[model samples]
Target: MEINHKIKDQITGFIAANSLVLIVMAITKYFLPPFGGGNVIIFSEFVILPFLMGIVSAWCWRKINISTRKQSAWTIYNTVIAIVLSFLVLKEGMICLVIVSPLLFAFILLGTYAGKAMFKRNNQTLNASVFVMLFGIFIADSLSVHRYENKVADTITVNAPPTEVWKYVVAYKRIEKKSDFWLFRMGMPSPVQSTAEGYYLGAKRKCIFSNGYVFDEKIVTYDENKDLTFDITNQPRDPEIMGHIDILRGQFLLKDNGNGTTRLTGNSWYRLYVFPVWYYDIWAESVTRNVHLRVMEHIKELAEAK
Candidate 1:
């Protein structure tokens, strides 16, 4: 009977800890400002909140007399549950969730270890003080402003001269070739065609993607076969992932190699609203590079064709 009673207590503690973690997540999301524009992904969401959830889980386990040896496994299990719940309840895209999983797991584990150390002496004062400090940090982080801008460029050597490449750079027909980019294959938008209303500055340009989404661009700088630059006047609104990023400008620079070939370089400037710029920037750069390559490759094919 004692063994059964102990098992029941463990189960009860597990349930309570998980419930508290979910509640904390919901409350934190409610209080934090929405991502993008004036709001950004703060440290609290990726770091502090997971840490607090770990501590809360440890507290519940300690109250139910769970052994220290088993706390690590229990904490991991609790975090997995919480993540699954977030995916279901929040309706987050799989790509976004996958990208964030590593950070969440790492911080939660650190918090669990910290909690273990704090509870060893069973000091309520220390625990309360730490909680207060964490809360203060969260508040301060929320009130601060964070904006990040990044640039990515891709260069390709085309078999044609600057004049031939320049024709396609201004505007091109539909790309009939299938995209080989992994992200585009997985449903991320890929460029399909581009059209220009005029051949001079202030011309209206439209770059259409496979998903029927079009990027509205205005020609800011036009230098015949040498340089073409445009500002993104409008972007697609349908894709949920697009909400976290804004593309500011795009440019194509054509240089004559003087050996019957041209060097085509594509440049883009964008702002990312996601947190931990170091991590997401890699993805952003990769996606942008692939987009540039895809478009430039199509231009190469057309320009080189007899």
Candidate 2:
């Protein structure tokens, strides 16, 4: 009977900790508006909230004499549960969750250890102070504007000259080949085709993705056989994946190699509303590079075939 009672207490503690974490997360999301109309803030979602969850979990389970390994395991388990619940409640895509899991786990573990150390002393003042500091930081981060514009570029050598490459750069046929990029395979959209209505500045262009979503673009800079730049007038708001990111503009630059070859460069400018710019930017740059490669490679093939 004692053993069963202990097990029941442990289960209850675990449930209570996770419930508190989820409640805090939902409340934070409600109070803090996302930078650009999205519902995710990197600091709160990935760092602060997870850290607080860890501390709270440790406090809830403080009476249980568990090994460090077990505590770590429980923390990880809590993270996984939170992620699953986020997916179900927030309707976030699998790819987003996959990308966010590592950061969430890391911070949660840190919090768990910190919490254990603090609670081991049973010092109420320290705990309260820490909680207040974290809340202050969260409020400061929320109030500060986090609009960041970043640019990513990829270059490829094409066998065709600038003129030939220019034809495809302006517009290309459907890409029938499948993208080998792992992310795209996992439901992140890949570019499929591009169509242009006119051949000069102010012309309308549409870049279509495999998901049947189209990016409405307008030609802002058009230099025949040299530069083709377009502003993204409108893009999809799927909310599950890339909706939080705003793709501002894109450009294709062609340079004559003078030996029947051309140097083709693709550039993309975007603003991501997510926080912790260092981490998310890596994924953003990689995704942008791959997208550029897919389109540029298609252009290369078509230009060379002509």
Candidate 3:
């Protein structure tokens, strides 16, 4: 009977702790005015919140005087549960979940141990200092109001000549090469077809994606088979979730390899209006690289087909 009661208490406590985390996340993500809107992947959401979560969980465990092994188990369990809940209930996109969850978990775990140690030492001065640090980060992020344009380029050598590759780059007709990559499979959206009105400098190019997202580009530079640059006039947003990224400009450059092949380089520049430009740039770079690679590879396949 005593063992049964202990088991019941453990299950109840775990559920209660996880529920608290869920409520906090939901409040931060949904209820808060500015925190959860538009750019939800800011420093407060990713870094500070996870650290707070870790501290709370660790403090609870320490208070109860649980074994070290059990504390570790609880930390891992809470992090997993929070991520799963975010996906299932909060309806967060897979890109954010996969890319940012690891960092979140790491911060949470680190905070947990740090909190435990601080509590054990009863270090009120250190606790006050940590709170001040977090507040300072918030203030700095809020005050630094500047946008940055980040660029990412991917180059690949195609088997076909420059002329042939240029044709495909301008307006690709239905990429049958489906991306089975995990990102696309998880609904990141793959390119479908691209069509253009004219081949001149002022022409407009429209590229469609699987998820109904379309990018409308106006030709800025058209250097025959050498270079094609366009500035994005408009882009579609996901109907379900608000995307924090905006593509500003894109370019496709071609160089004639001495042989029968051509070197194709795809470049994109995007503006980051989100906070903490430095940290967000890392994720932005990664996402843009993936986007460039997928399109570049598809173009390579089509150019070589002939």
Local distance difference test, each candidate? 0.80, 0.84, 0.75
Where does candidate 2 clash, by residue pair? none
Count clashing pairs, candidate 3: 0
* Best by the TM-score measure: 2
* TM-score for each candidate, following the candidate numbering: 0.83, 0.92, 0.81
Tens-place lDDT digits, model 1, residues 48-102: 8788767765665554566655766766676677668767886666666666777
Is candidate 2 or 3 superior in lDDT? 2
Candidate 2 lDDT over 1-306, as tens digits, reads: 867766765666567766876786676667645533454465665688788878877777777788889878887788788788878887778888888888888888888888889999988999899999998887777667677779999999999889889888888999999899999998898999999998999999999998898999999999999999999999987655455578999999999999999999999999887878888888989999999999999999999999
> Candidate 1, TM-score vs. the true structure?
0.83
Tell me the TM-score of model 3.
Answer: 0.81
Off by over 4 Å in 2: 1-6, 31-42
Q: Tell me which residue pairs clash in candidate 3.
A: none
CA lDDT of 43 in candidate 3?
A: 62
On residues 1-306, what C-alpha lDDT tens digit does candidate 3 reach at each position? 866765555555446556766776666556765542445445665666677777766655554566767767766776777778878887767676776567767777777778788888888899888868976875555344445678899899999999889888888888777676676777777678888998889999998888778889899999999999999998886633255678889999999997999999999998765545666678778767877787888888898998
